[model samples]
Target chain A: MSITREEVLKMAELARLEFSEEELDGFTAQFQGILDYIEQLRQVDVEGVEPTSHVSLSADFDPRMFREDEARESLPVEEALGGAPDPAAGHFRVPKVL
Target chain B: MSLRRIEEADPALGAFLTCDPGRVLERAERVDRDVKERPLPLAGVPVAVKDNICTRGLRTTCGSRMLEQYVPPYSATAIERLEAAGAVVVGKVNCDEFAMGSSTENSALQVTRNPYDLDRVPGGSSGGSAVAVAAGMAALALGSETGGSVRQPASFCNVVGLKPTYGRISRYGLVAFASSLDCIAPLGNSPRDIALLLGRIAGRDPLDSTSAPAPVPDYVAELDRPPGRLRLGVPKEYFGQGLDPEVKAAVEAGIRNAGKLGCDVVEVSLPHTRFAIADYYIIAPAEASSNLARYDGVKYGFRAEAPEDLMDMYRRTRTLGFGPEVRRRIMIGTYALSSGYYDAYYGRAMKVRTLIRRDYERAFEKVDALLGPVSPTAAFRIGEKASDPLSMYLSDIYTVTANLAGIPAVSVPCGFTAGGLPIGMQILGNLFQELPLLRLAQAYIREFPVAPPPLRV
Candidate 1:
């Protein structure tokens, strides 16, 4: 259950998050403790057990519960982009992918 | 008057992120005008909203700098319903960043103190919501529960908090931490107020498919008919080690009071109770990791100043925007759902979750509801468990099971510690059974009422 600093950094990279050197050291220790604590779940004999990923979704999966997939008015572009950190020409402007 | 109280006391209490007097007055006036036409359930009731629930024009921060200035385009279904039913939203309150922590200390914006003891932490991430009601800043408040957010804070502040049956209330505008576990719950000074608010906000929302299509009952009317001669089970595991003696004693006394109401209080074992925290940690964070992936610097929210590329922007924006605990959860989730470890971690945890749910199902078949302590102990000092995340996580042990099982549960003021800290007794009900659950809460409150915490405010 031990997670090394490299593994921590790798996980951070996957999560699209970064950490400082000090934070990494501190979080790595805290993270390892949490992992170790949750590790107790391994002991449960889960043979033939159905994973309850969602309580309502798993038990009650009626398609009728959802709204009809009808096209309707959406938020106007101005309202939609009102909170955008960076917007340009009715689009969320990001750095060039190329 | 809630606005004036917020202005006067919220400075010291640190309960709100934003409280615009002009908007509050406008909404109140509108409610006043509307009540003339017909009776409203929550007519003119002042409510403080958690920052995570979207309010059309007001900023929805989720207590994270990532969304510090982010204003949503539309309000949540619950908010719209609250307004339509004549509830005046006092303001948006603070919470743990992305509703992650057990204490309000994780709020990047402000530290909300418990109304009972100013130096103690308001159990969170619904600390501000609880503080609002306890200090009379608002009559009721909306707090979202991913783990023990609302109820834990209510327990700390001596108010009442309800985590309704999952999908019993719509999650349309609630900022998702763990989609399956997140519930936009209510906190109030009394169970009667909670019932009133629940009636207004509970029902199917076309916008939120997860919202139950089940008929909404008159919760306030149901309260008139007390839950008579009920079978109340006291889970033995919740009473075991790590429970503070004072809390344990107080809750036992509360169970005894239930017996006075003709309830059959018996000991039951939720064998998988010990594994709840483990299962919850894995599942909640795994879902959180996915839900929060939308916060990349692309659309809205805080963006990094200068990035060489999109990848750099994503990493830097999240790194700078999220707090330490949030980053830790995201990392844990990423690692758990990672290629080589998914089955061992997330998969195993989900199966374990079934065991936890089954434990509740079996107990409910024998007893109408389960009574227990909401938190392991009363509110601790501000920095006591902040440094140790594991210790903080342990405090939520008694609360997470109800959420994991998707059942309704409420925290009512049971008693107080000698140190004058407030303790709460948690009552959990079967799926979609909020009516009887609330009746039990109302009956308990009617029989043994704990005076509201005497705050200097």
Candidate 2:
């Protein structure tokens, strides 16, 4: 029935987004508004209408069709590695063996 | 370089979790050099990718620190198709950590703000991608919609977001959100661009068996054909609850406009619509928890800052890397799939998911497409609903059904609020029926002019 800033902060931390004290106030108010809004859904009386989950029958929506069975030419070693902040010998080079 | 535009506009807009100026300009330069005789339709177009998609050398972080430094060894099939089509990679945009949240606020990397208002959120888990395109950082972008992740953001950001029919596009290498529920979608300035992008990416792919073998229609061709006499279903369930009065007005406007285009608007009810969100959470998380188990630190991705041993590494890495929402869903999913709970939780949820699909099947039988507000409300100010997770979940109220049903849906900006925030109208069609969706979108776009900019840069 009630939402709290502590929960919001906890949720924000869980979500990995940082909010300054100034911004936390903003999010808390918005979350309340949104929660209050969602309350409207509680008003709909769907006593007999079954809850629907999946909409399309594509469940067996196979992923293999998007699969690449054969290895094809990829971007050049240099081209592919071109964006890495740290790269060595066409492979990404990072801190240590650990 | 386009980096400045985003950097200048993005900090407050929250369009990216990571933006490397040096790398983007370099990619832009390379894209310039690669422009050859091939008239790639989207050549030189900078694209922001949802973090969940594999981008080979990029961090491909999925907005989670668990893989903050992780980079895939291979490219996603959709990304491969885009690059082959000459689309330039701008950067990996933000998302709900592990594609869990409806607002980009769930992003472990950054809180992606909506372009419509700095204070309001851009919808997620594809929120950052939608923001990037709406703010013009990218001419186009790629997003993944398990529920309404892509379309909701597109609606909030005032752009075209398309969740094509399940398998219309390959999911190969898209970091699994909910494998069965997730579909890589297109977010762009307009519907034509989505059609163009879909053409290149759709069709059978060996890498993903779910990729549809159905012929990818020439969406542009359908756009030219008259959309006259088409049955447009307006489901009454979506009009209820949490929907902003202004957004509902906009949906009505969109309907009247389509009516002007000669499409017959009909009142069609998918009676089971209310259960969409509940059924979706159960299934998406059930699948996601199983998918996320793969991210244990020892195998790949982020490791704990200090780990005494392998087990310690898994626990610490996950505990530290995953944000709370991700953990919550993981826990929910774990509980749902656990030994004693599987039948009650996962099993029942799957059956409910089937019923949800059946609802759409029944509705589609009488209508060519369904329409409604993409989200219940227009852009809500940032930090608005982070506290109340229940309220935040409602953001996907209109979108989750499409994913649950495995159909095609597109969000097209129809009107703006009194405050000037965007209101997106959602149009959904049956499985493998992407062309009609695009046609309906294009017809609306012809009246709206939100497509690619009239003046080329």
- The candidate that achieves the highest lDDT relative to the unseen native structure: 1
lDDT of candidate 1 over B1-457, digit per residue (tens): 8988888898889999999999889878888888999998789899999999999999999999999999999999999999988899989998999999988899999898887788998889999999999999999999999898999999999999999989988999999899989999999988899999999999988988788888899999878796888999999999999999999999999999989998988999999999999888999999999999999987889999989998999989998999988988888899899999999999999899889988998999999999999998999999999889989988999999889988999999999998889999999999888889889899889999976546756
Report the C-alpha lDDT of model 2 over B194-263, residue by residue, as the tens digit.
Answer: 8888888887777776667777777766767766688888999989867788998888988888888878
Q: RMSD to native for every prediction? A: 1.1, 6.7
Candidate 2 chain B least-lDDT 10 residues: B448-457
**What CAPRI class is candidate 2?**
incorrect
Give the alpha carbon lDDT tens digit for every residue of A1-98 in model 2: 35577766655443333456886776566555533443334444444544434333344444233343577976577665544544676676544445
lDDT of 1 by residue, A1-98 (tens): 79999999899888988888977788888899999999998899999988888887665434468677899999999999898889999999998789
Worst 10 residues of 1 chain B by lDDT: B448-457
Predicted complex 1: DockQ: 0.80
- Fraction of true contacts kept, per model? 0.89, 0.11
